[model samples]
Target: MKDRGHVSTTQTLDLNDAGKIIDAGIAEAERIGNPSNIAGVDAGGCLLAFARMDDAWRGSVDIAISKAWTARAFDVETKALAKLAQPGADFYGIHASNDGKVMIFAGGVPIKEGETVIGAVGVSGGTGKQDQGVAEAAAQAFARG
Candidate 1:
């Protein structure tokens, strides 16, 4: 018998799997010709691995990681959060206090396994749509396994 709210579940991505996710993100970025910065983080919002492609903006590396952290911590697309942060929103300044580490943009997505969110992926240095596309590709790669 399990206690209510204490159900045991398995982790979607282990340390080894996290490495695979990073590799998938890199490959997807190359495929898209974006060559941007990509980052993957665990449920705890800790960075698992990251990469900055050639010609990528140096600052995008940090931005990608921050976006991943925000998505994982909040369990929603960073872009959606950005929408809520628009002028006159009740939580506008809330997302801004992360010290430039929380990017509420369209480049972050939560990694999920059968309805359980286990991590998040973020990409930057490209257009907002391009970033989201790359992140989605990476997430799909993980999901296929």
Candidate 2:
């Protein structure tokens, strides 16, 4: 028998990790004094976990989840997709074509470890920049762990 070197693999986010991401997002929202809704989803666009602040807008829950779904499904930030809707772009209808799962707006970011996409986190119920900030904070939290 020949000896073989050890193989290494990258870490990926599963359902439990996705839940942690959602928690981090909620915490970020609180820290920023922006009560909002947050959601996490797996790479396949399946919902892993979600949270809505006590005073968050009722509709933000659905929007946050949809944002996460969109990011996971596309493997990119929803904001980037939103940018593709420029006047001459061919994807102008993409935002409305995902059957309500695609929210082509800021606030959704994919959770990636190197090239491996684990899942995504999304925040809503604030300005676009505020939402993006919350999502970024959550992503940073997940990366730290």
Measured by lDDT, the strongest candidate is 2
Candidate 2 CA-lDDT value: 0.84
Candidate 2 regions exceeding 4 Å error are 1-12
Instruction: Give me the runs in candidate 1 sitting further than 4 Å from their true place.
Output: 1-12
RMSD of 1: 3.0
* Clashes by residue pair, model 1: none
Which digits, one per residue and each the tens of the lDDT, describe model 1 over residues 1-145?
7579877765645666566776787787788888888888887888888888899899898889998898887888887888877789866776658676778788888999889889998888888988888888878888998
TM-scores of the models, in the given order?
0.85, 0.86
Candidate 1, residue 31: the lDDT equals 83
Any idea what lDDT model 1 has?
A: 0.82
